[model samples]
Target: MIASYDALSEARKALDTPLFAGLPGDVAVSFEFFPPKSDAMMLQLWDVVQALAPLAPEFVSVTYGAGGTTRDRTHGTVARIISEARLPAAAHLTCVDATKAEVNAVAEAYWEAGVRHIVALRGDMGEPGAPFVPHPEGYQNAADLVAGLKAIAPFDISVAAYPEMHPDSASPEADIDNLKRKLDAGASRAISQFFFEPETFFRFRDRLAAAGIDAPVLPGILPVSNFAQTRKFAAACGAAIPAWMEGLFAGLDTHPAARQLVAATVAAEFCRRLYAGGVRNFHFYTLNRAELSYAICHLLGVRPKAAAAIQEKAA
Candidate 1:
């Protein structure tokens, strides 16, 4: 069996077999994950981090829970990524319930911890029924948060963008204008909320250009690890779930492996279209699992590396 496999491998190589080449050498990707709540989850998160570390992503970010529920956990997770994984980590900081002094303190601590990138957000209130009310002493909104972070340190900051327009926006024009304000206030880039269709992003990028805003906007890609859950989250976040998506996952309720196959196809196609349109930076929402994300990355042409090959190239 081993001899037969070797012969087949040599035959394939001799044919100079064609496989899809991935993105350009200059393209970059980053990942986002939330801190874990239990030992099992913690173990899972670490396993994922280790698996993807070989890719040498631009950064891996750990998210703060809504209303800043997991503030300490987020800090701990990000710190570990820096110290142990030795990966550049972007920490998510929010202004949901904290004052300027409080949030600035977190920024200071991150600086001391060697964390230089921040995904600043005006995080939502914890309870759905509860309206977000900025602390009387806190930054007012995302733009305010970005400016405050800039004032605290020379941290590279990324803010959220809405391609379909934010749900609470007065108008589409207003949403774009708000994005401009965040960039103008010192955000280095905007990571858009996930959108199903690539056109959603192209239109948003074009609008930003027309509006005279030049901040780099990174497309956020969420692999459908759980279609039902993603659908619900999309609805809550105002990301449109196209009718076709519903049909794609129609009958795979109990067949997770099959569902993942469909997911990889969809996300890879999305990335291919975006890349064709001149988008090079991608930010993946990994959800603390590597299988689907890794599969999607593979489909897009990103693969694990060989250290010896890398060293040889350097030489």
Candidate 2:
């Protein structure tokens, strides 16, 4: 029987409802951070790292900027997480502006620093809204980067997927094919760009299973901290801003506290639905902030736990 729209919406609401009691106390999570550019920002970054470190994520990643602009800083940050913080660090490596040898050298450095994971990307160049050109000497794209990383070390590689087709992707089918290539080239997992609707991610998961690609495509969740900024970014990233969401954030331009409460509630709702859909792993684009992500993790049955003293101990 075809479920009525009203019925499905009600079912989804029930599925999304948070259980403040008996929260499961276990879920796998990962966080992404960017290398700090200034001393003040570095202090804030470490403060956030210390706050979220107690949650004991499966691993934490530091993002590399477009065209490898933050390459050295990213290496230093991830290496510090490994050497000092006692956490497993994933360094993001991009196929942009650097040759295959340079990318390999970075990977080798990460390995030498005791890092075991890499978030590989075929990054955008020029500017945020400008055209992307593959570097003349670099690996052409993420798939090639993934293949090269595997050849360099037995790294746990993760690549990006877009639930809404990537702007540059030829088609949904081609995007899936690209993802498959990355996986076949030895990527162990795929982390999707953030989206609002759980059904968009669920549908993508169903299609991937149908295509016989069984690697875990983790649902990426971003807790909205600023409505206007989020709307702008979602538009750029090809994610839909649901009308319902818009209505809730309608007129709180100056009301920061209410905005945060509303953001936390909405993110928790989105995640509960995903958890009900059998998603056990989540990657959060934390925006270098923590409260909202921490709250959503709470709703997902994850709690603040001590950091793993040794990498293998947590593994």
Candidate 3:
């Protein structure tokens, strides 16, 4: 049933009362992590992974940076997740700065290492507003990359979607067309870029349905780790920030603790609203930070558990 964030808040409140038991069960989730940049960052990333492993995400993804940057770091992270953590990882691969053979080799490496999922993307150009010029012998776009990966193995491929249209997209319609192309070329699913207002995603989903695309579109949930930075990135990527969001973050810049509390409340409400709207899956852009995501997952019925057995079995 379609419901609003307010309705969810009221429902959760009621469920939490002494007379009513709160909702229970694991909520399926997935996290997005970027490659670590330094030794300190690597230690922090493992801590975050250890903290969230109990949630039993469908899978976690390691992001590939622009222009094929972080290629080794991403590979190492994915390989470690598969070999050490007993978690399935989806490594991001793009049609940028790599030939078809190079791309295929990466895919083959992942498959050989037992990492069977990939997030295929026709990544951003090195500089904003610059036209994408394909490599001399590389895949032209995400579709070609998806097809190439499929040729290497039966990977669970996921591609990106734009709810408000990618910055370089000629129009929303063209963005949808690109999404359809990726799916048609063999992507198993699509994860949308983060947006604040739920309606933006709902409208995009409705439009896709009307246009006859039936792929599973996972909502990419990015809890505000740093409001100011998020806003700047949002603007650069063409995502709209509702004025309400600004008001919510207002006066909290100097108050980090309160700001984190508010961030958790906002993100929990966002997921509750989407849940009420019939979205059962979420892909979190964790930015390799743990607290807000852990809190949000707890609110959604995700709880900590033992990763011990899985580690032992894998060993």
Per-candidate local distance difference test? 0.83, 0.86, 0.85
Query: In model 2, which runs have C-alpha deviations exceeding 4 angstroms?
Result: 1-20, 307-315
Quick one: ranking by TM-score, best first? Answer: 2, 3, 1
Instruction: Let me know the TM-score candidate 2 reaches against the reference structure.
Output: 0.92
C-alpha lDDT of candidate 3 relative to the true structure: 0.85
lDDT of 3 by residue, 1-315 (tens): 335676676556655663213547436788999999999999999999888777777889999987778888999998998776788789999988888888888888888888888999998777766778899999999988888888889998999999999988888899899899999999989999999878888899999999899999999998997899899889778998889999999899999999998998899888876765667788899999988888878777777656774455333
Q: Give the TM-score of candidate 3.
A: 0.90
- Report clashes for each candidate as comma-separated counts: 0, 0, 0
- As for model 2, its CA RMSD to the true structure in angstroms is 3.4
> What is the C-alpha lDDT profile of model 1 across 1-315, one tens digit per residue?
975686565445434533235333456778899999988999999999988776667788999988678989999999998877777889999998888999999999999988999999988887754667999999899999999888889998999999999877899999998988989999988998999898899898889999998888999999887988998788777899989989998998899889988988888778766765667788899999887667656655676667544333222
Residue 201 accuracy (lDDT) in model 1: 94
Query: Which is the leading candidate under TM-score?
Result: 2
lDDT of 3 at 149: 86
